[model samples]
Target chain A: MDFERLYRDHADTVFGYLAFKLQDRQIAEDLVQETFLAAYHGLEQLEGVQSPKAWLLAIAHNKLVDFLRRSRNQDLPLHPESLEAASSSAPSKLHMQEILEQLAEPERTIVYGLYVEGLTCRELGEILGLPEGTVKSKAHYARRRLYQWLQEGSAV
Target chain B: MSSEEYKELAWGLVYGTLSAEERELALHLVSQDPEFLEALKMELELKQRLAHLKRAMPEEAKERVYAAITGSRSQVLVTAVLKTVLETTLPRMLWPVLQILERSVFAGEQQ
Candidate 1:
């Protein structure tokens, strides 16, 4: 299945999504390997599938969730420099991250998929196992929620 | 439509996912509705802020993953070779030696 090609194509996007979701670079790195290994083993199933990128993303997302579940239900830790960013400069960046951390599961994933990963609604739906309409609706809700939180200066 | 509905429309506009008709409606709202404009502004700001959070994969991490992929293939090859030797050759070759060693060790202990 030309694993090298697949890795070269999707590795960065997968890693970026994981980093954004987990907010932990080290853990994201480990999970990236695991995700690729899983994909390699499942190559037969992936043959002729629509949207292979979403397929890879779905695997990465599941890996991230499984890791979170095993890790004692830990909250998403802020970035290491979050405090420094908050105090020294780039408070808005830290603030946005904190707000993202507070978002519920699908919403947070939705927002990350939409804005950060630049996934289309169809791709997002495929990765999330939701219908396209549902993805769009969730994206709408997530966008509204984020906007509302930013407007209120508090987590929604 | 209600303000909340307009806000949802505003989201579609900002995301560039709105249909042509929907975009027209949203644009009209943006022109006339202060809340919708504020919502649009917030959406744009959020996108910009979130852009700051997009991180590239560290180079070391990329190297580590590539190494792991290569290592996994190597491990599979080694396992297959070891399995072939163990299943077909090692049991016959080692059984007699193992039995002899076992007898020698336990024989002295019993004595």
Candidate 2:
């Protein structure tokens, strides 16, 4: 795989996923670097890999999980306010973030991955280590909840 | 099919994850069931709205990744400069020479 091209294509997506999950720009940025660096090292294996974006995102997800685990052990603050602070000037983003915040884990990630990142259910299943049927079900429930909330105008 | 089954199929349809048979079933449900149609509409709308929430990686963060990949900030800067030269300045500078060479080749062919 052409590493530079892959980075150009999916860096924003990987970074966005990390930033959304971590809620901290600096940590997300660090993780982005690490993710790409790991991809760079694994370039040979990436040959013939379909859906490089999903592959990079799976790596990013792993990185986020590791960061979360380490943070818990180290007592590091994830800086949830960072997302708020970053999006303070953009109400639409802040509003979206608020709505996303209302979702539970894995579902929140599933919704963001499927809708925002445009990842396939199979890709999400691979990334989240769940069966495709389970990913679809989670996505179904998450979408329904979001739809009901939006319809009620409660999340607006 | 159960309501849950129909909803799962609807989700599969939204994500394009359904097999041919599953899709046919979902479409059949969409035609026959008003509730299924409504759910599909809402799901599609939610997908559209959520798509708009995509975030761009900040320029600084992108630079960090580039630097990390390329080894250092200075290396990235140098690579960027070299790429610009190769893509733009060098091509323009060599254009006259290339034109002259082409003309010479044409003249030789004529002779």
Candidate 3:
């Protein structure tokens, strides 16, 4: 596989997904390196995968899960404040991000994967290891939760 | 279905993820209820707001990543550390956390 080409093609997507998940630019940047490094070493296994972008995303997803688990073990909480702190006040982006940070997991992941990354319910199901129906249900609930956040001007 | 359930269905309609039968239910409800229409509008607006958050990877981070891929490990590690140190505008509260993060990273590298 052409590693340079893969990095050029999918790095933004991977980085974006990580930044959304981990909500830290610095950490997301570091994890992007690990994700691509793992991809480089695992290129042989990727030959049969149909969507290399999704494949890269799944790698990024796992890297994030592992990173979070490790951080948890080390007693390092992932701070929504830090995510906000890292960014300048780009209002719409900040508003969307603050609401997303308010959302519970799986829901945050669901809505973000759907709207931000433009992943379909089927694709999200595959990445998240849920059935498509379950993914759709999560999307529904996530939107309601988002709407509620909008109405409240704060998330519950 | 309950009103809350219908609102959720409205979300499915707005997101285009509803099955045909689900879409039928949602449209039926949507045609009847002003609340459902409002919900659909809100969902669409939320989607638009999310679209605004799109950001490309920065050049420095991109170079550090590619450097790691090409086996310039030590050089990129130094760059990362130097960048962190030289970055003068980081919020005061984030500094200690960044130090902890660096320690964890270096600790992982050693093992």
What is the C-alpha lDDT profile of model 2 across A1-156, one tens digit per residue? 577788888888887888777778788889999898888777887866777887788888888889889989999977767766555445654576678888898899998887777677788988888899998888777877887787887645
Candidate 3 lDDT over B16-54, as tens digits, reads 778999888788877898877887777677767787555
Q: Which digits, one per residue and each the tens of the lDDT, describe model 2 over residues B1-111? A: 665566556767988878999899888888899988977876676676676556688887797679667775456578679757766766577877866876897799799
Clash list (residue pairs), candidate 2: none
Residue-wise lDDT of candidate 1 within B38-83, one digit each (tens)?
8778767766777766667867779889899879978878968975
Clashes by residue pair, model 3: none
In model 2, how large is the Cα lDDT of residue A76? Answer: 91
Ranking by TM-score: 2, 1, 3
For residues A6-100, could you state the per-residue lDDT of candidate 3 as single tens digits? 99998989988888777688888889999998998788878887778878888888888889889989997665565565466876566676778
- Chain A TM-scores in order: 0.75, 0.89, 0.80
Give the winner by DockQ: 1 or 3.
1
